[model samples]
Target: MSKLDWHADRGTHPDLALLDLAPESVDIDLAAVRLYRLGRVRAEMNKRDIGAVILSDPINIRYATGTRNMQVFSMRNAPARYLLLTADKSILFEFTGCLHLAEGYETVDEVRPSSTASFVAAGADIEAREKAWAADIGNLIAALVGKGARVGLERLNAGSAIALKAEGFEIVDAQEPVEMARSIKSDEEIKCVIASLRATEAAVADMRAAIRPGITENELWSVLHQSVIARNGDYCETRLLNSGPRSNPWFQESSSHVIGENCLILLDTDVVGCHGYYSDFSRTFHSGPDKPTDDQRTLYKTALEQLHHNMDILKPGLTFREYSDKAWNIPEIYEPNRYYLSAHGCGMTGEYPYLYHHRDFADAGYDGVVEPGMTLCVESYIGATGGREGVKLEQQLLITETGTELLSLFPFEEDLM
Candidate 1:
């Protein structure tokens, strides 16, 4: 086997200086960065002729207003917090107890308590409560942009949409503008992602050290979860922890399955790390008292080659369709279980501009250009037609003006290869 040049030195990168500065000397102005982000969003809004935007997506709200409260809860339910961004002002509609939390931020022009009684009214019919909630939101929207004004709305519940239309407002799709603004990350955002990746990689190293036969998948997963939390990192978004046969088809969450001798263990750390940035990467391991079989080694090598090949092809200025045209093609035998895309963008979490394989691009692809300052996750899943296990590998990348930089430094399992 050839020696792989694992880029283990994180300090050599120019960005490392940003991470090493003393708190007093460091040029980390979060407030300024937040203002820059909001400015970018507003610029996009202006280009689209959007008067204001109603943002309800948690990530969008954070990007626009820099507020974090009950984020996970808001993902499934209607957001308890919302922001109305206008040309000259920003108004945050927060839940009653949460209004105080937004007071410290200079980004918000005003903070108002969002009505919660309607959401919790037990005697009221569900439809009535929804109507009441929508009415309140519509009234707020009207106050911000006035009646008959054109507004961009993101993540609006059906009831809210109807109410807003009834209130004589023109609603346009606002998600794309926010996504486009977020797609190109700022230097501070890059730093946050780097911090998260560092923490997540450290946790993975801890898990690798503890890997062996007889340990349950959950136990190993807990080690990673604990390591991230101990470092003051936010919660992981997925439990993509699985071993052996369970790892074949992919997308399996961690379970109580015991690690058997010479079995492959795959883990994807879909963790949200420092400063609310997400670090997503996957590493495949082999539990051992014995070396992996030849087939396992082959699988690992194939996946690693695919990973590097895709990374090499990625750079600034490539269109999504062009990338799809050049992406690695899975063999006919393994095509059935192939993942949806070879790569996807990442920021707050797994997000847009998913670069599809040539085979899947015709039906699943979207058109966009890869620009500098975009961060992407290049993925590889290699499993045979009847194989019991597969190799899963992913690397986070940041597109630079000249080329691309690898953000994730976690080494592949050399023993498995």
Candidate 2:
């Protein structure tokens, strides 16, 4: 009866759908998550004989200390803030005037004003500023772990690494230690993921509610963005919503094209959601007063089949290469347009240990074991070369001690199925 009332009779109203996904409010134990994450990083460091890890990546900073400030800006604005951690101490070089953000976090031992070395901030004095910033960090490391200790640095510039090396620290790439640590999720971290997914799927339902003929692609995609923010989620990591022909090649961002009577809308929810965990899943919908054409249904069915077959074969201890060997066979026609990864690690964001399709394995695949506590997204995109449309489907799963558990609960398009 109303514009947003598309699915009332099917009990698929956005409000009701959200209630189903999160029937009751969920509470995350922030302290537990923070401490568990910190312990994980330390354990990895110990394995590598690393005495300290210096982190500038906003994501790594959040992972290590559970404190955040202007993350999007800080991602590119190097040295906006950083974290230095040793076996016994944790220090946060917070953005100016943002010290209060980590006031009560037990994982953070000290919050000091960050010394920025960006060219934009320091101009001609950048080299000196880098030296000064490096000196300050060098002093802290010396105080905590002493000089010449092996230190890992993440997402830092080459200049900073040189400076740290000049400070008598043995610099190692921190990405490995950090990612290996993050590969496995703690129980509390899983709770944050579940909460984030509930919010994300609810946002998706609202996006679906707004879909109709003549709605511009941007208009439809905006609904998802608005709903995520409304639920206290941080942001959508990508603008990957597309309609009709744009769905065939994929990777076309949402734009101003108006939807016709029947079109395929594909979306990848790269949502960096609640508590800073990621909720990555994808689905394709049919916007219709007219039923989907035969070709559209074929694509949808093929993708669903690929997704389920791949998902069913996953379990703890499966080697990445072995998974590729057992992965669903892709038909020749769909080979050119196949999704790059059959599956990939998902946590704070799309992460390490990517599993490639069998045909592509030798070139891009690497070896690793899929262990318990890892969350992954299984992906499928089926569209024949030069076809008019495509179908994208993905499912997020958590690997448990027993087997795989489905984490994403968004329903597929039954009509298209």
Candidate 3:
């Protein structure tokens, strides 16, 4: 349905108030997005001389072929369903009775019943199942590439890996190609990102509107969940909302603690939002009947400074190390509790190219150049090791040919500033 029609019909629907405030629906070409994304993965695979890739990671499967089946369930259930992509053809091994899920998608060339080998599916017959699964994979690889070719693989169980190896295929890490392919965005993909961010921010607004002096952290967080689902977005990947002292350490999931007057609440939108794209930005709110304290304002300003400074230096061709070298210097007191990544890549989920802080780079860093069309989330957290509260801030932006374009439009709490 058109955005206006949907909104008008749901204008008074109590559960959909956030949809009414969402930006008008964007026009996205689904076929273009599917084709472009599939082509990217294929190009990367060919560049690496990979004969075939077996993708079981739900995110990778979705990225490679625009088809999703039991994403969260399939994540933990190895080889429940997977895709086999060769340079010339695309084949999906779907779970039984779910073959229809991939029908008519231009990205998929064929769909067949998956060979179930995971213990949950096979039980005591797991060994026999593994051998059978390997045979199925080997037969396909032999037809498409040949016996003993360099095959790529994503997350798989040890038994499955051994089974593939027993088939004489040299398994290589396929994530390298898949992630590299996903790092850059097409115009069509960016349209979906924009729509996803709009939906997420609308939910954020509803969450913020619901925040008051006495609401429980879980109650406040549920507002966002309701709005995102009501807008047709998928589930959030995190429960990252927290209030008052619970916000100090960061990474604490939402709880039932009641918010108090003038205390700070922090949220990270690790949402698997519209079209399976992620909306990962953070904000800290002051639940106020009272003005934010001096300590709160200080934390907010510092985090804002860190976020803006990193975003300002982003551009195509900048190496990851160079970006780290020029990042805003965090005060020593906050170092112990700082956010691990200064910035990271974003697409279907928190993805490739994790940019580490200068402090952590000597041991934990890797080098890569930023490229145009890459979407990134710059992050900041300001709280001393023993501090009572903290402020978390993040901004999602597109790294353009010349500079950066901010994608998230949620306003920082002005009162805290």
Residue lDDT tens for model 2, 178-280: 9998999998899889989989999999999999999998999899999998887888889999989889887899999998779999999999997888999
Sorted by TM-score (best first), the order is 3, 2, 1
Q: Please, what are the lDDT tens digits per residue for candidate 3 over residues 1-417?
A: 754455446332322323333443346766678889999999999999999999999999999888888888888786789999999899999988998777667788899998878888889988888888888889889988999999999887878888889999998999999999999999889988989998899999999999899899999999999999887787889999998999989899999899999999999989998788999999999898889999999999999999989999889999999999999999999999999999999999999899999989999999999999899999999998899999999999999888889999999888989
The residue-level lDDT of candidate 3 at 63 comes to 93
Where model 3 places Cα greater than 4 Å from the true spot, the runs are: 1-25
CA lDDT scores, all candidates in order: 0.81, 0.88, 0.89
- Between candidates 1 and 3, name the one with more favorable lDDT: 3
Question: Tens-digit lDDT track for model 1 on 64-108?
Answer: 866777888776665567888988889888876777767546578
Model 1, which residues run further than 4 Å from truth? 1-27, 116-123
* lDDT-sorted candidate list, best first: 3, 2, 1
TM, every model: 0.90, 0.93, 0.94
**Residue 302 in candidate 3, Cα distance off native in Å:** 0.7
In model 3, what is the error at residue 180, expressed in angstroms?
0.1
State, as a TM-score between 0 and 1, how close model 3 is to the true structure: 0.94
RMSD of 3: 5.3
Worst ten-residue run, lDDT, model 1? Answer: 2-11
* Comparing 1 and 3 on TM-score, the stronger one: 3
